[model samples]
Target: MRAVRRPELRLPELRPYDGAELEPEGDYDGLEFAGTDCSGQSARGARFMDCALRRCALDETVLSRARIIGSVLSGVRGVGTDLSQAMLRDVEVSDARLGGVQLHGAALERVVVRGGKIDFLNLRKAKLRDVAFEGCVLVEADFGGAELERVTFDDCTLARVDFSAARMKDVDLRGAAAVDIARGIDRLAGAVISPAQLMDLAPAFAAQVGVRVE
Candidate 1:
């Protein structure tokens, strides 16, 4: 299997942003949003390039259809953060604590997610390419109808993930710490897993094929 390409981010000197409130369709470039509370703010269709969001709050922040490129989000905490239909490229997200986030129809490329705990993430119909998730805990993440290419899960815990109607190519799950699929286990056509993982999922596989083990 080919290795997943990681994001190569080189952030320039950024100006500190002390903005009062997020504006819709705002254009922010080379800015650092440090310790900013952006909860319940609407930044829909905003564009953020070469930016760093460190220790920022994103609860219920609307980033739908937003474009985020060459950015880093570290230590961000939030619930119900919406990134639906957003485009993320060459981004690194680390140590983020999020729940019930919506990311349906989003496009992610060359992104690396590390050391984060997320729950109830909604990624239905999203497109992912060259993405690597490492050392993260994901619970109840939905990937229905999503397209995945060159995606890898290393040391990550996937619990109750749904992949119904999802398409995959070169997806590597061999390094996952744990894996649990609540639905669509038969849709793993182009995914790679370890023999131990296959054994662990044998019951599910048998159930799918209607083979009873007595």
Candidate 2:
């Protein structure tokens, strides 16, 4: 089994970001956005490097096509956060409470999401590499046509997740607390699941293969 590479972040001394409305295409570096309310802020095409956003509200915040590198987003809460087509590398998102977050066509590398509750996450056609979700609850996440590599879910709860047309490689789902697939039950070729999970998904498997268990 190929091991996932974790992010090695060495953040330098950071400056505090002023609580001002985020501007589009803003360039932020080595800054800390703590307790910032970024609701309805549009930072489209922005660049964030070595930054930390702690306890920030991101409701309807638009970060489309933004580049986020070596960042830590913790305790962030919001809904309808738009991160479409964004590029996130070496990022850690912990304890986030997000719903309806749009990450379609985004590219994530070496990202770790821990202890979060995300509902209606839209990752359609996203590219995920070396990403790990630990102890998180993902409800109704849509991964249709996404490409996942070296992705692991450790003690995570995935409910009503749609893997329709998704492609996986080295994806480890053995440590997931629950795996409830709402669609694409037959696309488990490149995933690793435990025997218990296989048993739990037996009905789906049988249905996929047209097996009748009377």
Candidate 3:
């Protein structure tokens, strides 16, 4: 991994100076942490703009009510972090660990989560509009009470994911495996599926009706 460039505090783009180890002591705006270790910290009502967090360990960090825009978080380990009430837009987080990550009441737009084990994630009451999950493992994830509009799951592993009480509109599940689709039946809230997948699930449907469709 390439070394991230340090932010010049005197630059006009970066403001409200806060050290890597020092907490802002209060709500701060436009905080930046590039090429640093900010693990096991609590940042409340903070915002990170144009930050590059490469190879950093943000494990067990609590970033409630925070917003990160246009950030590149490559190789970040965000295990069991609380990112509730946060908004992440135009961010790319690949080769990262997000296990047990809680994103309740958060909104993700145009974010890419590729090649990561996002197991046991809590996305309850979250709004995932225009978000795409590609090539990621979403095992036992809870998407309950979420508003999923125009969400696309492409080539992703969605085993035992929960989407209960979510309002789904125009959700695309094309190219997703059949095993993954079956797990999304009750969890899909009110989302619609393809006709081919519906036809393929005839046997499961028949069994529910007390009929053997062998």
Candidate 4:
């Protein structure tokens, strides 16, 4: 990693923070930042609305108590980052890497994460509404104690993922591969897998139900 420097990127209602790495900073509401690097920094209580974060790296950054409404966070890597108590609405995160990211107590409404690698991502005690995970690889991701409503996992790889104690309503796990479904079923409490998925997960089904496979 090179020396952390804030780049010149402009967004609506957004301004560059001029200072040596801020702590205990204020909020940034309705701001957009493009091609910026806020990596390895801590942004607490920052609120962004109608904002766009293009090609930004928030890796190892601490974003506690932040709220983003209708924002686009494309191509952002949040590896080993903390986003606790954050609220996101109508957000889109594409081509991001969230490996080892922690999102405890976060709330998301109408959020979509596409084409991302989210290994060991933590979403404990999070509340989700109308969230979609599309074309992503989620290995060993944790969703414990989450309240999920209308969440869809479309064409994603979900191996070793845990959803124990998560409240799900209208959640769809259809069209997921057999190995992925097997991992998901390990921690599923209140969810339904499609019949087509059952056929694909025959190996796991046999293992779970004590049925011998010839």
Q: Model 4 Cα displacement at 208 (Å)?
A: 4.5
lDDT of 2 by residue, 40-146 (tens): 99999999999999999999999999999999999999999999999999999999999999999999999999997999999999999999999999999999999
> Least accurate stretch of 10 residues (summed lDDT) in model 4?
1-10
lDDT tens per residue, model 1, 1-214 = 8899888899999999977799889999999999999999999999999999999999999999999999999999999999999999999999999999999999999999999899999999999999999999999999999999999999999999999999999999999999999998999999999999999999999999999989
TM-score of each: 0.99, 0.99, 0.77, 0.80
Each model's Cα RMSD: 0.6, 0.6, 7.0, 7.8
User: Which candidate gets the maximum lDDT versus the true structure?
Assistant: 1
Candidate 1 Cα deviation (angstroms), residue 23 = 1.0
Cα shift from native, residue 173, model 2 (Å): 0.3
Candidate 3 colliding pairs, count: 0
| Predicted structure 3: lDDT | 0.68
User: Candidate 3: lDDT of 44?
Assistant: 60
